[model samples]
Target: MSAPLEFTLLHPANLTEAVKQMQAHPNARLLAGGTDLVPNLRRGIGAPDTVIALGGIDTLNSITETASHVEIGAGVTLAGLLASNLPTRFPALQAAAEIASPSIRQAATIGGNLCLDTRCRFYNQSQWWRKANQFCLKLDGDTCHVAPKGKRCHATFSGDLAPALLVLGAEIRVENAQGGRWQPLAQLYNEDGLDHLTLAKGDLLVAVRFPTSETRRSGYLKSRVRRAGDFPLAGVAVALTRTGDKITDLRVAATGTNSAPLLFDDFADVIGQPLSDAALTQINKRIGQAIKPMRTTNQPGLYRRQMVAALSKRLISTLYEQGAN
Candidate 1:
């Protein structure tokens, strides 16, 4: 039988206190909604000596908007954001949030989703199941079952909001014992699954900021096996601006297709061109080539790759049509 899990829970009064607590407990795990961490804790995936709960920090749960951008605190619930004017301001984000079930949305926070753990078919099993299979590289063992001879882990990132935020050019604010720094959300991830987030020890995700413009038309599309409560098999998020049917600005990003959410900078070649059939064909081809899908989910890698191409095409085409009308 496995030993029972045990940990001390710390509730900091505010962001400042939270940082101090995190610094003091270097080996602690931050808990926002406990949706992901609790389950992982039970399975012994992360057995921290302390669990710091950020839910008590009020400032981290508010949303503030400026003329240039919208700042969403890390503690803001998915349901809270969806209920706010964010839906009208950033419809694509709202659509992505709605993809999760209403129950999860009610309890899951934006920060938790952004900092979700990398998942693999071989790694997410229960303790007994994993032990029986001799454990993969992400856990206790040395061999990577997914890529036996490979040097690194292949667990796939499965965040829903990351691609949408990335296409919007979102910035993340992280705080630690020394101070805080704001960086492009794209820089916060690494392709390696074992050490996926680029955050330093004791660094806490504070908020997410992204520019908002009436001229931008955006959309998010996800492919999943089930209609609800399933992490995306593959997903795409797109934002673009058009002037009289000529594309002026374009950003494309994808998630659930790789170890980290990816920004398809190669799609920039489509800028200044209309969304014509030929142009879309070229863009779709680029997307198919750019995404590196792995067999981390129940679906095959080939099917996920195809879905990425199809979803990218659909999102871009839908946004173009909507912008035209």
Candidate 2:
């Protein structure tokens, strides 16, 4: 049986206080919505000595828009985004956020979703289950059950918003007690699943900023076992600009296929061409070759790989149709 969770909870009044608390207790796990962290804690994931609550910090929950960009606070709930004008303003982000069930949307924060832990069939089970199966590389065991001979873990990054944000060219603002900095959202993750995020000790994800442009068109597509409440098996997000039926700028990103979400740099090659069947076929082939899905979920790796192509084609076709109309 699992031991009861025992830890100190700290409620910070503001962002400053939150940062201070995090800096003071480097081992404290920051809790925003607790949709993911709480479950992991119950599964005996990381036993942090302290849990710093960021939900009370009002500034972290506000959404601000300027002439240049829209800044969404980390604490903004998925339901809040859906209810606000954000869906109309950024349809792709809205579509991704809408994938979670209604109840989860009400409680899950954007920041928590962004920093969600890498998941695997072996790692997410109960303590008893893990013990019975023998711990995998992500837990206490040295060997990766997914790839026993491989040196690293094979857990998959399963967040839905990350691919959308990456294709939109969003930037993340993170702060610590010492200072703060902004980076492209795509840079926040590494290929290693065990240590997926680039966040440092005491670092807090403040907000995500998306550049505002009238010419941009975007779409998001997800494939999961169920229509809702299930993490995606494969997903795609695409953003582009079209000038008189010719692609001007394009970005494509995928999630749930690798250790970290991927932004396809070669998508730029599709620019200056029309979104015709020939062009899409080439793009589809390129995407199929680029993504490397593992057998982490119950679905076969080949099926997940095929879904990547299928979803990419679907999203691109939808975006193209929207542009034509």
Candidate 3:
């Protein structure tokens, strides 16, 4: 890959200034931890005329707690999140925050991870390679290689934290030129590979709020070709609360197998059911049904679905055991 194309970089000292810069240059891509954007730049994925660097904004790096929730700033690194006592309150997030290598975790922000670009074998290649392939639906080309007759792209979203946060009932704080608003973390993403994030032009993700609870027990697990530094072939996160050996609240979410992080629907319907073999089988079936994996990675789509189901059952069983005892 070649060096990133030349662009003017602006450092905003405050959130207000950052928002103004983004508003002024609507096409300017944001630079947070630079873990993903920089690499994409080198790959000729985007060539923004201006880049707004958010690392200079102190507010985006703080972690604060209220009686009901804990707010983690968007710029806080994955390592920073794991270091805080907040992850102790949500083990699934803590587990997910440790993704990739130590150095990568130290530089990758939750915001960047959440807003990670959708990926596919056909799209994430170098310029010459993509050009040779004649491009894909996500970029210069009109055809979707994954489904030649279809009109949509099938790039997968591989972020590890989103599924963890999704099951924990997290909400994000979004700000733009107009002002700020809070939306459920689940609402931040859509299934489309080309435009996965629901964020509008100039919208900046400020922070995420995790609702506090005493009895929730959660954990996360991933399947990959390597033990470290590999994006998950399939990842699952489960959060549940037990009441006298019956599951009180159960939430399941997964990543790396779909265009958007998936939250298993009808999970609430199983509330109050005993965590038994039948329950596990039910969850496994739901996971198999929900995962819509395309051939974005080396692994087959059916393999990802199977691995995700197994990972989900294993994680839910473990959490249920811990919550039961």
Clash tally, candidates in order: 0, 0, 0
CA deviation > 4 Å runs, candidate 3: 323-325
The sequence of per-residue lDDT tens digits that candidate 3 reaches over residues 166-271 is 8888999999999999999999999999999999999999999887654478889999898888888889988888888899888889999889999874765568
lDDT of 2 at 1: 35
The RMSD of every model to the true structure, in order and in angstroms, is 1.7, 1.6, 1.3
**Model 1 lDDT-worst window of ten:** 91-100
Reference-based TM-score, model 1: 0.96
Best by lDDT: 3
Off by over 4 Å in 1: 1-4
Q: How accurate is candidate 2 locally (lDDT)?
A: 0.85
* Model 2 lDDT per residue over 1-325, tens place: 3664899999999989999999899999999889899989988888988999898999989888899988999999989877888767667786646467898889898899889999888898889899888888888888888889999987999898988888778899999988899999988998888999999998999999888763468778889998878998998888877777887777788889888998875765577888888888888887777677887899988999989988888888878777642
Local distance difference test, each candidate: 0.85, 0.85, 0.88
TM-score of each: 0.96, 0.96, 0.97
